[model samples]
Target: MELSLHIILEKPTAGVAFGLQKGSGNKYETVQIQQTDSGNLDFYLTVTTKGDRLKDALPRFGGPFIQGPYMGNFIYLDIGTLAGQVSPWNRRLKIPMAGITWEIIDQLSADVALMLKTNVAGTAKDGSPNCATVKPFNGWRVVSK
Candidate 1:
């Protein structure tokens, strides 16, 4: 079953937060980002399947697509295909920015959990950074908190 997922990250900052919202040990300190009234950056991502299920009785079709920064990366989509399926399903997700660079972030799948929660570690090209921790701020679903 090919499906898409909507991933969301909340309350992103630099040198603060953990898990998936950590910034590059302040490396992204100067990175440009839009802030909300409550002081949070939101990222939006959309992923889609590549083919339909019922082909013209041709060979089965469908597969996974991956693209983005390596190591400590964030994925927004997760595409799944059966042994011989045709059509594919899709999901949408919105993530929060942890001061990471746009060039470093990539979208791979569409079914990945709308990780309303995550960390923002620095990019590899930017060099290693100190360990950062992250967690939900209000202990609520990404939509509520």
Candidate 2:
């Protein structure tokens, strides 16, 4: 089964918190977001498996998985370049001077998790029992902070 989640940010600086339930028992995971000192956003992931069913299924489903924003594929845009392209008459173009929004961060996190899960499943199908730690196809864009 494939799952996707979308979280709207309440504010530009506000963090995001969500949970991902796995297996048929009390196994679950938490994904938390926080701002770093360098003006970058970071994620803290924690997985918990308390049932025997979940522990047994860990080999196939791959448990104890954690990830951050830098572990996924994303696109970045340069605010200055974007603003420069706008016509002088159209002064309504307001550029964001702050860091990235939580929406983008949440989407990136979901995308990374999905990719990791899919890769692990595919590897298992190919007769590999271990979870696959595949690198993301690309990295986020470096925007001016």
Question: Which candidate gets the maximum lDDT versus the true structure?
Answer: 1
Candidate 2 stretches with Cα past 4 Å from truth are: 1-15, 18-26, 31-38, 44-61, 66-145
Candidate 2 lDDT by residue in tens digits, 1-145 = 2212222111222121212222222343223422222222322222321224334322111133422232131211111112133222211111111233344334445554432111111112332211223222222232221
Q: Ten-residue segment with the worst summed lDDT in candidate 1?
A: 76-85
- How much lDDT does candidate 1 score? 0.26
Over 2-111, each residue of candidate 1 has an lDDT whose tens digit, in order, gives 32322333332232322211223222221122322233433333323332235422112122222223322233211111111122322112122233222112222232
Q: What lDDT score goes with residue 104 in model 2?
A: 38
| True-structure RMSD, every candidate | 17.4, 19.2
If scored against the real structure, what TM-score would every candidate get? Answer: 0.23, 0.18
